[model samples]
Target: MAGLLAAMTVSLTGTRVSAIALPWFVLTTTGSPAQTGVVAFAEMAPYVLVKALAGPLVDRVGPRRISWVGDVVSATAAGTVVLLHALDLLPLGALVTLVAVVGAARGPGDLAKEIMIPEAAERGRVPLERATGLMGVTERLAQTAGPAAGGAMVALLGPLAGLAISVTCFALGSMIVAWALPRGMGHSAPAQEAPEAGQKGQEAGQEGYWRRFGQGFTFLRGEPLLLSVVVMVGITNLLDAAFSQVLVFVWARESGHDAAVVGLNSSVAGATAVGGSLVAAAVAHRMRRRPVFFVAFLLAGPTRFLVLAVDAPVWAMVTVFAVGGFAAGFLNPILGAISYERVPRHLLGRVNALRDSLAWAGIPLGGLVGGAAVVAAGLTPVLLAGGAAYALTTSLTGLRPEWRQLDRPRRTGPSVVPAPRERAGTTDGGRAERSP
Candidate 1:
């Protein structure tokens, strides 16, 4: 468990750092917001598609292997970018291609780490919510540290230096997963289930890849609450991608600030988020999920955009971001717990993959839309529009009947619950339990 978390932290930190370095590099070099958006799209389009496809593979081959291999590929791609640039051979086209490779590899790598979390929690004897909160902390810590370091690197040395650091971090993450984890950990789903179910499980193992993928999709389609959450999160993620990839960078440049200020904004939010994650880790299990989720969304979503849209003072902007970050901290743990509680263990990889892919599907277009909007109407108007949309989406989504199930108690054993339209069964030890 410790090894997994450590590996995740290192990898995520590198990704976050690159997020700063790559966009800044593109914007400065091209001096075109549209090109910046294209770069972002080049990366995320492959990320979403590959991730959606990689779920069955992750389950079939084992997450540990997929994780390490993906990291290695990502490291190579990042290193290529640095090497080519230093050699004066890197073009915008090449840079976009390399980042696309990184994104493609990153999809499975991140999903593998996420798929391992429930097992890690079980091994550590931690409750699901706390474990997810800890995972959130790990992410928040990366967000806090990565941007700080990237900003410094970009300011002092160059953006290339930051990219170089990303290469090193990816390599280290690969090594950690390859060598640090215990043998037999993160085994294939079939191997893990075979002993318990004997021949029946082995038969299921023989199912084709597309069949397995279809099952995950079918299962996800049947869950109304999960579907609603996915849709809402998808919209928010799109806005966030725009905010981070284009709007904020443009805001900083237009406001006569540097990359350091950008880093500072993210780092402050991340720092406070760590505190929020810690608190959630300690007590979220005892809290009502619906209110907390909605409240957190309210604080986290619209405020950052509105603050920037108004061209607030740096101090004021930072303060709002800090508050928003803290609120955002409580979100993932609750969502993760709910999803983990609902999905059966054997289906974790595919189900989570589909869920995450759907939620992230809009991200590839966020930068494109933001860049075009900025070109058409400028930053402030776009920010205001995004903020209003965020506020409305989050606020109105809570009224749905399905969201009320957010507070459902965690089951003691595996959730063998069938989809809504499936046949309901008695509460026997091994039957298909009904969805709410």
Candidate 2:
């Protein structure tokens, strides 16, 4: 368990470094915020589009293999960026294309890490929810340390050096996961045997990797509860993505704060994320996960932008950003636990990626649109509109009948069907077969 956590932290640190270096790379080269936005979009577009397709592949190949492959590819891509910049051969268009390639490879990598968590927990005998909470904490820690580490590394050693550090961490994360995680091919315990391999994965509600990817689309089409959750998150993601980077820079510069504070602003938010994650770690095991989730989703939406619109004093800005960042911490774990509780293991990978792909679809759009909006709308009004949109989306859609399921006790066991409320009606499998 400790090993898993450590591996995740290392992976998260690499993620942190990339966030800092990628933007700096574009900004330094182009001297244009719009171009930076393009870089962000280029990377995320592939990430979202490819992740939608990668989940079934992860499941088919097994997450262990997929994760290792993802790590190796990601490391090479990150390393490529470092080499290009170091050799002074970096071209703007080529750099964006390279980052996008990194983004494409990262789809499976990110999903592989996610898929590994619950499986690792099952193997290690730790509670599934707790393991996911640790993943959240790892992300919070990464955010807390990522920007500062990236900034310092880039400032002192250059962005190429920062990318190199990210590459090393990615490689290390992949290697550790491959070595440490147990195989789930029914060894010590059968636990549950899924569909037979090479059976086309389409029978019994399954499909081949490519076929299963298509099936995920069908599966999610009518599920309003899951769909709404995906939509609400997608909207917020777009909003946040648009404003997240620009807002801080605009806030610091507009307020005439020190050049040093420009970077520190993100750090403050990262710090607060650690606090929020600690809270998530504490309450993550509770049965009633919905109230906190509902509340966090509703609150975190506008609060992020309201603080931005006010353009508070630098200290005040930092405080609010910190609060918002902390609030955001609850999101990933809560959603992950729900996914674990709700989704069947057989289809975990494809569905996980598909759903996440939906939520992330707007991320690149946000990055691109925000950059253009800044020129036309100015940062303040754009921020104001983004905040309002966030609140409206959350309030409008979350109050639905399907969403009620999130509040109910989730179905459990190793089956796809709902758990019987009363013991009398229970059966051996998901179906209502007679107890002979």
Candidate 3:
């Protein structure tokens, strides 16, 4: 678990450093905000596209292998960028292409790591929720560290130095994955079993990649509770992107606060969020999933926009955002645990890839949509509408019948493993079988 988590944090830190450095590099080089946006888009589009398409490949080839290759690709690309810049050979087109490659490789690498978490938790004999909380902490720490390191490196040494740091991080991540983890830890069992391997070969011969992808869709479609969670979370993610990208900046600027105010508010919120994840890790097993999920969403989702709608004082806004980020911290651990518990071990890679891609689809367009809406309808109206939508998405969606499944207690005692008969009815490969 430590090995995997370390690898993830390092890789994620590299990615986040790139997020900061790449924009600054582009802006300084071209002196065009338009080119910066284009570079950003170039990276993210390939990321989403590759992730959505890589599920079956991950399932077939194994996540450990994919993760290793992904890191290598990213490291090579980042290193090449550094070399090209030093040689004065990196044109805008080449830079964009390299960034796109890094993004494309990172997407599956991330998904592959995600697919390994449940098994890692089981091996560690820790509860899934706690394990996920730890995973969240790793991510939060990376998010906090990456930008600060990136900015300092860029300012003191230059953007090439930042890219060089990114390359080092990626290489270190790859080394950890290659040397630290046990052999075949993240690979599927069927790949090693002769009979299962034969069966897989037969299936592959019969069904194409699209068919395998469609199988994930079919599984998710039959599970209404999961569907509800995905759609609701997807909408919230869209709202969050908008808030982070456009609304908050506008509010800070219009309210006569400097960028430092925004940074301070975000730093407080992020710190509290880390604390919340640690708390969740400690007490999650004792808590009921449904109420915790609902309350977290209620506090975290709509409240920020609502607070901004009234144009509250900086202190009030900071307090609201801190509380909201803290509440939000609990959300992912619960969701991640539920997802792992419900999905079958064999299908984890494909299903998680597809589900995550769908949920994340709205992120790229969010800033564009928010800016357009602010232009057409103005900021206050947008905030109010976003707040209302978030409330409706969470509150109204929670009333649906399928959400009751979330209330099922964590299976305890010696009979943690389900019998074959008990597992027959499950659609999504989970231990608990669901009746259609």
Candidate 4:
């Protein structure tokens, strides 16, 4: 558990740092928002697609191995970018391709880590909400530290230096996962019963790639609550991608600030977010999830964009982001708990991958749409529209009947169909566990 959390923190920090460096690099080099959006698309498109497909493989191959391989690939790709840039051989096309590779590798790598969380919590004898909240804290810490480091590095050393840091962090993450985690910690899912003698070959063939993939999709389709969450989150993720990948950078440039200011804003939010996460971790299990989820969304979304839209002072902007970040902190712990409770253990990898992929499907298009919208409409108008849309989406979605399930009692076993010969009362070690 210690090793997993540590690796997650290091790897995620690097990712957040690169998030800043890569976009700044593209924006500065091309001086085109459209080009910047294209670069973002190149990375996220492969990320979403590969993550969606890699679910069955992760379950079959074991998350430990996949995580190690994925981090190594990410490190190599990021290093190549730094090397090419240093040699003055890095073209826009090449940069896009390299980032795409990073994104593709990151997909399964991140999902593997996510799959390990419930097990880690069980091992540590922690409650589900607290464990997930701790994971949220780890992420918030990365968000806080990564942006501050990346901003300073970009301002003082340039974007390539930040990319170099990303390479180092990825390498370190791979090493931690390889050598530090306990034995049998992330092994493949338990095997099902043997096929009947007469139908052995046919059954074996049916258990191949597509069948495994379809099982996850079918399970997800049956869960109205999960599906509703996915759809709403998908829209918000698209808006967030646009806000982070394009609008924020553009705002910084227009306001005559450097990457340092961007870092400061994010870091402040992240720092405050850590406190929120900690509080959530300690008490979220005792509270009703529905109200907390909606309230958090209300405070976290819309306000940030609306503040920027009004051309508020830097102090005001900082305040809004800080408050919003604090509210945002409660979100993941609740969501993670619900997901882990609802999905069967055997389907963790595939089902989680599909859920995440569906929610993030809009991310690839976010930058594209935001850039084009800004080009056609202008920043202020786009910001206003984004805020309004965020408010409406989050608010209207809460009224649906499916959302009442947010506070459902924890299940003793999988909510969906169990595997052949699996017992009804048995769970991960006969104890109910959650994830983040």
Give me the candidate number with maximum TM-score. 3
lDDT by residue for model 4 (1-114), tens: 789989998898889889879888888878997798789788878887998999888877778889999999999999999999889999988998999999999989988888
Identify the candidate with maximal lDDT.
Answer: 1
What's the lDDT for all of these models? 0.81, 0.67, 0.77, 0.80
The local lDDT score (0 to 100) that residue 300 gets in candidate 2 is 55
- Candidate 2 residue lDDT tens string, 100-192: 888888777777677666667777787766766677777778767877788899999887778888999989988787776656531111123
Candidate 1 structure quality by residue, lDDT tens digits, 1-436: 7898899889988997898798888888789977987887788778879988998899888888999999999999999999998898989889889999999999899888887888889888998889888888888888778877887899898888999999999999999999998768788877775556666677667778998898788877777777787888888888887898799999999988887787778878889989988999999989998899889888987999999888899899899999988888888888788777777776778888888888877766787789999999998999999999999998899998877777875442342323324311100000010000
Count of backbone clashes for each model? 0, 4, 0, 0
Ranking by TM-score: 3, 1, 4, 2
Q: Which has the higher TM-score value, candidate number 3 or candidate number 4?
A: 3
Tens digit per residue, CA lDDT, model 3, 49-108: 898888878877788889999999999998998899889999999999999999899989
TM-score per candidate:
0.87, 0.84, 0.91, 0.85
| RMSD each, Å | 5.3, 7.1, 5.0, 5.2
Clashing pairs in 2: 201-206, 201-207, 202-206, 202-207
Model 4 accuracy (lDDT, Cα): 0.80
Model 3, runs deviating above 4 Å: 192-207, 409-436
Task: Supply the global lDDT for candidate 3.
Answer: 0.77
